[model samples]
Each structure stands twice: as C-alpha cells, then as structure tokens.
Target: MRRWHALLWLLGLLALAGCTRMDLAYRNLDTLIPWTLDDYLDMNREQKHWFEDRLAEHLRWHCQTQLPGYLPWLDRFEQGVAERSLDDRALRTLTDEAEQAAAAVAVQITPSAVELLQQLNDQQVSDLKVAFAKDIAKRHAEKVAPPLEEQIQKRAGNMIKRLEPWLGDLHPQQLAAVQSWARQLGEHDRIALEARARWQRALLEALAHRREPGFDTRVAQLLQRRDSLWPAAYKEERARSEAAARQLTLELLRLSDADQRGQLIERLQHLRERFASLRCLN
Candidate 1:
C-alpha cells in the first residue's frame, strides 16, 4: 500500500500547492494508480480490469466529496497568505487537515488494495520485494547517502525552488533562514529513509500472511497509520522538522517585500481558481 502512498503526497497537497501542471495531474488521477502500480505490481489483464473499475469508483467519490472540502481548505490557506498571517498554528492546522485528507483516500482505496493484493502470486510478491529494494537504494543514494554538508545545501536549494514559485525570489534573510532550517535538519533525511524502509519491511512481512485472517486489518494499518512503523528517533525528528519548516515559513514571510507578498497572494488566488475549475473528469 505504501507503494501508492507517494501518490497521496504527489497527487494531493504537494501537487496542488506547488506544481504548474496541477490541472493535468488532477485530471489524470484515475489513470495514475495503474501506472504507479507498474513499479510494484504487474497485474494480469483481468486483475487490471477489476482494479480499474474500483479505482474509477474511488476517483468519483474523491472528485465529488473530498475535493469540495479542499476548496474551503484552500480558501483558508489563501486567507492567511493574503493577510500575511500564516502563523505556525495556521500552518499546523492546514497540515493536520491535509493528513486527514490523505487518510480518507487511503481508507477508500484499502478495500480495492486488499482484494487485489490477496490475489498476488508468490512470484508477484518476490517482484514486489525486489522493486522495493531498488526504490530504497535509489532514494538512499539521492537523499541519504550524500555527505551531510552536501545534503544540507541541496535541501536548501530545493526549498528555494519550491518557495520561489509561491513566495517569489526569497530575500537574503529568507535564504539564510532556509539554510538554517536545512542545517537544523542535520540527519533527518536519513531518518526519513529509515522510517520508509521500515514501513516497506513491515509491508512485505504482512504480505507473507496475506491469506490469513486479519490481513485486511494489517493492510489497513500499513496504509493508514504508518507512523507506528517509524523509529522513535524519526518521530521526534519529524516534530523538529515540522517546527523548523514553520519557523522558516514565518521568517520568509516576515522578510518578504511588498512585491513578493503581492505575488504570493496572486499565486494563491490563481491556484484556488485552477483547482476550482477542475471538473470531475471520468
């Protein structure tokens, strides 16, 4: 289930909030899953048809029900952005709502996931394990295997890239804040990788007993409540990371010039309009 979890992040807040191609991405949600699953599961034709039907149903429910809630949430975020008052509390509130939104998607998809997963042969399971190993290795090389200083610099650079789209080019003070935040994160990239690897291990273990009783429950936990798989250090580091992100946001906003704030408001408005205009594509 964690195989599709990245889509939860990629298709939701991160995509909607940052990507220039949000509309295209949102429109492709129905097809995204089958494509993403190719990395983990190579389904037979009948299984693919069955999953497509379920995915279509889930997509309809999401477009009809879940997406409406996002409009109000985006409005709230835009309100704070326009007012130049996105405090830590407001940011945390939005983050919590985003987590809830992701959980809902996971809940909706779990039944389909469980049904399809239970049908996988042992060869498919072995392939999944191999796929996971490759993914973890690639992620580690990209994010965790780097020297600490290099990682910090790349992290800051990436933050600047994401922020510039919404906040415009950051002031020097804002750039400094970003660097500080990145440095403060220290070994967090490693912690995040460890947590993800732990989750995958837990998932593979669960799959070994996929036909046993309580399998659905195990998949639900794996899908919906992955925090239980986190190392204790990861949990603590996650809190620190969130706090650093909030502080960085506050610093960036405080340092932003009037033009940057204006650009931010305009961008948020454009994003809201774009999302609002996305019809429920079948």
Candidate 2:
C-alpha cells in the first residue's frame, strides 16, 4: 500500500505545527499519492478512477473518523511541553501511539491496495520494477555517495531548519547537540537502500502470484505486517536511531529558553485548534 504517506501524516500530527507545505500535503494527499504512486506503477484510466474513488473514501474516513482522535494526544503533548515533561519516556510512548495510528490506517487501506494490485497488467509490473531500480539508483547517488562528514553536516542543517520555526535560532551548543546525534547515527543510507530493495522485491513477488486463490489475504498480510518483514539489522538500527533521536529531542527541549517554549506552545495550540475544527461529528 506504500503506507509511508499515511504514516507520515499521522506522525506529523504528533509533533509538527507550522510547515505550510506539510499541511498542504495532507490536505491534497489524494492528488499527491497518485503522483507518487505513478513513479512506481502508472495506472490506466479505469484504474485511476477507481483509485481516486478509494482515495476520496480514505480521506473522508481519515478526516472524519481518525483525525478527531488525535486531539487528545495533541492535548497531552501540549500539556507535556507546558509542564516541561516531554522526556524520553514520554517521547517513546508518543512514538508507540503514532505507530499504532499508522498501523490502523494501513489495515484500513489494504483492501483497496489489493484491488489495485489485481488490476496491474504485466507491463505495469515491469514498469514498477524499472521504477524501483531508478529510485534505488537515485537514492544511492543522493544519500550514499555523499561523504560521511558532508552527510552529517547536511542532516544537522536539516534538523535545525525543521526545529527553528518552533525553537527560534538555536545556540552553538544546541547545534552541536544536533550534529552529535546525527554523527552517532552515521551511515544508515545503505541500510535504508537495502531495505527498500527488499520491500520492492517482496512486492514484485507478491504481484507475480497475484492470481493465486488467496492473493487478497497475501497482499493484506504483506501490507499490514510490513514491520515483521524488515531485516533484523534494519530493525535494530532503526530502534537505535529512534532512541538517540528521542534523547536529542529531550536535550534540546531542556536547553530551550522560555521564549522558545512560549513559541512552541503557541504553535501547538494553533495546530490543536486547526485539528479540532476539522471534526466531522455527523
């Protein structure tokens, strides 16, 4: 199902606030998903129309049913920030919550994804493989070929940019903290690249047998059990990176000034209000 977009939107609801582009991405996700999906497999007119209908259903379901539940979590986060209690444990709990939310969305969308998979002809499947190869090459060149030091620097810069809106201009020590955390998680590009290849290979294999009697069940299992399919090394590295990131976030929050905290609280409040306004209780 390529559940990253749903997962990202769900997770984004947990922490981020003021990125207009991200907000637009969620608002226009139906269009964006098709555009992104086209990179892997282009759909014919009939399939595209089916996809659009299913996407609209998903969007409406998400907005009307799923989004409202996030309000409580957002309130808890805002309260955590207000009380200066967003520590490592709290962060881990939030991560679990977000993962569960994403999993729920994945389960909901699996049937539609299976239907789409059944529609793919041989040429489309070949095109999908070609797309995967192209993506792997592009990612390798962009993320892997860069020198280690450069990658660290670039990652640190991106972290700073993402945080600056909420935290304002960071001090030297704060920037150093980001750099240190990034350096600690060094060279995950290969792991991610390999993981992508494995996922795509699995997808291709599943497509190859799409005509089997239990194809729907197989596809559902593939999408819903995506984490279980991950290589153990990838899981371990991902966990380590997540823990380090949590520690870094807590440290940064501890280092932030009152003004920065005030700004963050304001942003959180704005997001909470925005989310609350979208409740379609009918």
lDDT of each: 0.74, 0.73
TM-score of 1: 0.89
Each candidate structure's TM-score, on Cα atoms with residue i matched to residue i, is 0.89, 0.90
How do the residues 1-282 of candidate 2 rate in per-residue lDDT, one tens digit apiece?
Answer: 333343444363333322332344445545323212655776899998887788878878877776777778778877888899887788778878767766777788888888889888999988988988998899888878899888888878877888888779988888888889879889877787788788888888888988788888877767777676789989988788778777787787788889988988797688667767753644
Question: For model 2, what is the error of residue 241's alpha carbon versus the real structure, in angstroms, after optimal superposition?
Answer: 0.9
Poorest 10 consecutive residues by lDDT, candidate 1: 11-20
Model 1 agreement with the true structure over 117-177: per-residue lDDT tens digits: 8988999999999999999999999998989999999998987887777777777888888
**215: Cα error in model 2, Å:** 2.1
Q: Which portions of model 2 miss their true places by more than 4 Å? A: 1-6, 9-25, 29-36, 279-282
Top candidate on lDDT is 1
